[model samples]
Target: MPDPTPPGPRAAILPAPVFTDPRVTLFHGDAVELLRLLPGASVDALVSDPPYGLSFNGQAWDDAAGFRESIPHVDTTAMSAPEVFEVWCTEWAAGALRALKPGAHVAAFGGARTWHRMVRGLENAGFEIRDQIAWLHTTGMPKSMDLSHAIDKHHGVQRTDRIVQTSEHDGVLGATRTVLSKGTPVTEDAARWEGWGTALRPAFEPIIIARKPLAGSIVGNVLSHGVGGLNIDGGRFADDRWPTNVALDPGQADALDMLTGTWQEGSMSRRFPIFRFEHKPAARERPRAYGVSHTTVKPLALMRWLVTLVAPVGGVVLEPFAGSGTTVEAAAGAGYQVIAIEKNADYLPLIRSRMEQ
Candidate 1:
């Protein structure tokens, strides 16, 4: 095997690690700054869920100073907000590239509205574009505005027929009750636009799988670097079937089984058991000591599967945008040394709690 490369400039000047164990290390700082501080070609794989620049639920980090709208002095003449977001992505991705070993793969989760921009950034940052994995879920809430309701409010019509509904959800940010729709449309124009909304119900999230340029041919790279190739056998399904690009939550898998039915081959009879999301952020997965305040915590099982598929055994895994420490937690649990970096100070406690567990 080839020797690991030496650390670059500023690699030694790392922020004091907030949490560290034999298997896991956590850093609290900017992702780009922390990523550049890592030794060159040290990390074996990267699995992150970076910001989508959507101003999602008015979160400040994802907004990046109102990234959706063009900010002053940024020169938005030639580039739109989405293009600007792509540039931001390229900056961090380039830093990630310096830290990753040759042939290391990245599984970065992206939003449907802005996935293309994120992919473009990764491509520009010297990573080869690989397959796109889709994770379908049944519990997707749409952030759409009702056009009919807006028209009614504009006309100042108060509908007598009003029904109040309370919705309780256990999401990344913990459990909460949301009251939806105070009233329905009342005016003629509102009636015409009834049932029309601004957006569609979200069902799936895309995970872009990209790889660093290999040092040599496939076999040669895998032998020397212990990466560049996926762990196909290790990632096989419970039924001993090969994995697919499409993943589904329990609800979606059950629905598919109902729609398409099952198949039998030889001694095995099983349903369409593609890659199912076996791990979720339920009471079992997350540490009960810390309340989950992070908005975009991915399913723990999904992250585990991603790391296992890409990273080699006993290799180091990196998560630049370590929101709630899901990626690091997954990697460490799967027996890989993990480095997690998060910028938000408030979330440091959350990541540390997971490490303690």
Candidate 2:
């Protein structure tokens, strides 16, 4: 085999002003190196949405001689998919477990393709798989498909008030866009018209919640609750029916608002601002022009939900691949100590700006 490669440098070695802050320790360097510096079992929770190993945004390799004049020296493409993922999961899981207090939990976010691999890596790092929770979102981008138009009239004239039946297409296409009014039809066509529905939008992804098992004996079977589904005791005969897919109505919004401590518009008005920020689009103009480091950045709502679940009230949370500091912001919002490590220096300022705001 070739000579073993040297490990990346730790992010903790940066200026004192960077890592000294306990509230939010934002390290602008390689996570693998930074994680090595942290004491084992030092965190209350290890929550991160690592790169999917797909080399998203093409940051895996550098083509500096091409259109782009310069590139970040650190290229992740040197390692194979399995090697990269294994290193990522193992390093963080080991450090996280070492950092956590006994019986603490870790919720890692990953795509379907590498979710199992991550779970396996965590298991190897000595973490027990607890529950695989689905972090479902209420909003997503639209998908396009080719719709075969059945021309009912051969007169080459568009029929007035004619029904255009469209089935789901795999490819993107611009057609009669869907629009929906409140309490209107929930059909595919209606959803299309209203720009609602995953068929027309991007598919919702799930988050895996795996816990580091407590050392003691079984404590009467731990009880757990599902956010979107039914309630039951540990020994009850529960049928695994498909989870009830309830849209966020006024009542659900009110309940969630209370749970998440969202500010109410008014005492009488039941509407909560939880979804308001959740649904807010990216800034029309970015603060600075930087190449896309990662696509499908995790929303703050999803990160906050995970942080609240796995981390203790004031415990430290570690994100190995702290892209854009979504986890950092969420952890700060939830009042937990956070240490975010990102290798890309260009995104460091962006993360700082967002967190400082």
Candidate 3:
């Protein structure tokens, strides 16, 4: 994902590191700027969580609003313009490519809505599109708008009352009546939107996985660079149960056999994970972190598993957006070295604190 634009003056590298542990080193600067300092084909893999451009809660790091929420700004969604965000992704992915050895893999967390933009940018930056791993979990918090409130504001309705749904005696569409407390009336429009809401309940997060194009054959890539190819055995489950034709309907399975003649052993393309993770613990709602806080805190168990799945033992991992240093902790715990980068200086302390933990 090299930049096409002409290069400008580079930032001066400091003489020493900001925070360093046995397995982790964090740099306080822009990811693209720091990425250029690494020699090409140096990193083994990348595990990171970049801003989803949702402008989540108007946080400064989320790029939603300028500085802070109270301060007046254009209500920008992401930290920058749409074009700028796209460029940012492309540039960083390019930078990741340069830092990563050929045939290295990248797994990045992204919002379901905007992740496609990131994926396209990565592909454009010359990474091969691998399977997108879905981290299934429950999320009760939603960003959808409340239509009832909007209707009230539009009708200039103001009152100090509570919503009371009581089974009152007769009148107004049978016994059960939904009335604003104190018998306050609601417009037909307002009543109509009481239970209606926008957007689906977000239930899953997408981890876009990709790999830098290999230098040659898979064997050559592994032999020369000790990268490329996932640790299938490490990532594989202990149970033998795996992908089968059960997912298809019985009739459909039969139809396929009738159409293409009876299938034989080894007919399937690849094995799918038989065991599914409800991720109830991870999916539960949590308060949004604000100001200097990094809202998205990936579970350590999940991060460690992902690291083991992506990188080999003692391999180097580069995390571009190392918010709170969860990646660093996971890497170090999983026996890998990590280079973490964060743009906002505020989270440096938080990252250090978490890595220490």
Candidate 4:
């Protein structure tokens, strides 16, 4: 049997500062190692997108390295296996829990396939499980392999190499070329799953909202430590609608009809209207000038709202898995003091450029 202990610090924990300012601080190293140096009960809120144990990045899958849109900069080393990844998460959560004040909230992003393991790990680390917020989007690409296509290729059915779809004119074809799929079809020996897909179309990502157990009642806790309440009014939607757990992808609002004022909830529903929103694209000049942003980078609008939802005005925020410093950018833009740490040094320059811009 494998030993069930979390790994110790990967390197020596240092107190030296990487980059520091009045509004923002940046660190490039192992998150758990860096987190161990911070004092307990220091940060007001925690928001981050940690490794979900899915080996989707370049280093894990050799067939997917160096793609233009793939995570060329991120080489995920913490996710060797699910159990090991869970231990990694638990270690960081323990550090984050110690760093957070009592009654503070944490909003963490997790992948759909590994969300259950992440939640269990966090709960074990002393966080009270509150809710799972889903961010829905329509931009997911399905990577399921077509079984029928593979079966045909196995039966000596060679796919069309290259062909010109152009019409022959005067017994001569044009000098241009256009290729089309040409493969044998599986008929009598077709399996039941021949036409069926292996996976569902991707849609939403789950964000777990959790909190540290308070030392006292809600009001008492807030009065004592200035933490423990959600900023509902400050983060509400327009037309008197309360904040909801659902958010939409960019340009998704146009497809929605005008929501009426008369929203009657069921007995089990929260007694207010739920609302969703679309994030407008950031100004083109910034991304164009700096090159495309991080592949999994959260939109600025969504990050801004999420930071405000948990962290109080002028409160200090901590993001341990800070990829490209999106959370740091959001915090600084919202006038909150933030500390951002990323394991990948490749993204440090990009974060600096984006934050400075």
Candidate 5:
């Protein structure tokens, strides 16, 4: 890979490209800055998994409280976390709007709790709201707290029917266990909410698809800009089934099969309404030895499908939030011109390694 110095005119506002090859360019900096610096109407598509504003695992990058402080001219003191995140998204989405060519699309992943805020932000930034694609999975760990357990603890009552449940993961270092209550609730408040938890297990993540306004008609725009159209044939399933808005992992597909009573459509089976993706256990458990440790690494297969769906053949794909570089790796590996911007410098090495592969 070539670490070429940026041109003199852009060097003032832009840093040198960290890793630049014929197919890919990696930058180490804030996404907003890079998005602003990109040449207007130059990028063909935008696909990324930006921050979810959930402060996941206490990671500062995902924390909206501190992120709000960095948005210039925005007073976030009284704003809630989700509200602040909307402002942040609008800021970058505006930059993206300027950088993307007319009729290009943006495929962004968002948290379930704050997906509407992201959509609002995109709409606020002048992008036309398109359909939302659901990335269905069954692997999300529930973050709900047990109401009965909390009530019992607050009342100072010790339950004797607590049991430890352990599950070992493949390729993981050790087993993870949690305490479960099996005994009757000792307090009235505990008994009232004995079987209830705060939240349900997460089953799906929303992937928002927004598009820049077309210069003219869709056919005219595609002819002029080489974009503004989905690669449906490229994204088609086996037996020429057109891809649906729902993308499913193996677990989710299995669940849907159970619910609908079949998977593949045949003389003996019923057809389901899903586009099943290749299973990727490695997406959940990345190789720590390579220093690839982004907490929310997306499945490479899903990323590949997304990039192909939005971007035209051999066109430029911009990934503003290249966490773990899955989108970047997918875009580049699939033979598109890629520009990957990552805010956290710690993951740069992992991204470069992925590009080399």
Candidate 6:
């Protein structure tokens, strides 16, 4: 046979883009518009946490009470709960799914209430619901006991708020008693008091990992009980086990201990270290008061781990809703070519600044 032609530069795997003077191209408009301009099958992975339609507005709530107080200020009365979810999953997610490569994974972070609808929408869009990973955060509000009280109370008009207050009071009393009994330093022991009781439980958000079938081939049985199935790693079914079930309490002690040491700058040796960096109060601080601008910002370490798991070295990673550019920065750090798209013009500068640094 004649000598094989050398692979062209475009065909050759590109080197990982460096963070210093990185080429982070920003689209300062709607993501749907940006995604439409990009070539299909160009990305190796897709990761994003889209708007939950909850309209959190990024204000810091002191407690469940504070959150409740802020509700009147929000326009939640316009649409029913289910309607809001359908709009996000069906409308917004439709745009997101179209942006992914075949066999590529789209990890979307969402609350429990909307996860099922999201899965159903993804399945309808010809994507396989692979794994439902739990992203347990350290900051979360307590659960509400209103439903239980509503069931128990014979009054036609059930006062759910009263029950929640009672539960909160009990939790505080229990914590005070424990502190007195143990004589432990209040500052050190105070965290124990905020345990996940009926009223106040840690928030459990789910990260749905869905995959698009490769083009021109029959979609494999994604529900198969095998290595690449929905329960690939032996976790419970995605439908049954919602991410909200996982508590947002402090990470395991081992994980916390790993985060205590200072991270070495520009050292790839500590890639995907098991430590939980966002747990640190300083790291969680936000510059703006409204909507945190990026409240559900995924930790850089977490994004790095996910990027490495899904994309090979020098593979392209795409984040359609690149809020604050966490996915882009992490992808660059892990030796992956990144393409980030953000709708908010205000955040373009912030994203560019982070990537350059």
| TM-score top scorer | 5
lDDT of 2 by residue, 227-312 (tens): 11112221121142222222232344555667878746552132323322243224421223254333446667656756765665
Consecutive 10-residue window with the lowest summed lDDT within model 6? 172-181
lDDT of 3: 0.69
**Predicted candidate 6 versus true structure: per-residue lDDT over 182-301, tens digit per residue:** 222123223344232355464467878888775544334222211121222222222333222222223533343447664345221243224333452233322232223445566776
lDDT of 3 at 87: 56
TM-score of 4: 0.76
TM-score per candidate, in order? 0.86, 0.57, 0.74, 0.76, 0.88, 0.57
For 1-357, candidate 3 gives per-residue lDDT tens digits of 998999888856533558898888888877766787776798999988888866765656656332233223223355445445555677678878889998999988888877887898798788998878766555435656557766777898854575758774642123554555432326678777776668877756788889999999999999999989888667654365432212222223334445787554433222222223223323221212233445677766567767877787899999878876778877888889988888777778877766655
Cα lDDT for residue 345, model 2?
Answer: 66
Each candidate's number of clashing pairs is: 0, 17, 3, 0, 0, 8
Residue pairs clashing in model 1 are: none
lDDT of 2 at 150: 18
The lDDT ranking, best first, is 5, 1, 4, 3, 2, 6
What residue pairs clash in candidate 3, if any at all? Answer: 1-94, 63-78, 63-79
How would you encode candidate 5's per-residue C-alpha lDDT over 1-357 as one tens digit per residue? 876976565354678899899988889987766788888899999999999888887877888865775585788889888889999999899999999999999999999998899999999999998899988887777888888878999999978877778876633324566676467788999999998998999878999999999999999999999999899999886557888898887667767676876545431122332266645446442524353467788877788889999999899999988877888888888999998888887788878777666
In angstroms, how far off is 188's CA in candidate 3? 1.7
Alpha carbon deviation, residue 63, candidate 6 (Å): 21
Q: List the residue pairs that clash in candidate 6.
A: 57-291, 58-291, 58-292, 142-200, 142-201, 143-200, 143-201, 204-244
Model 4 stretches astray by more than 4 angstroms: 1-13, 59-80, 161-194, 250-293
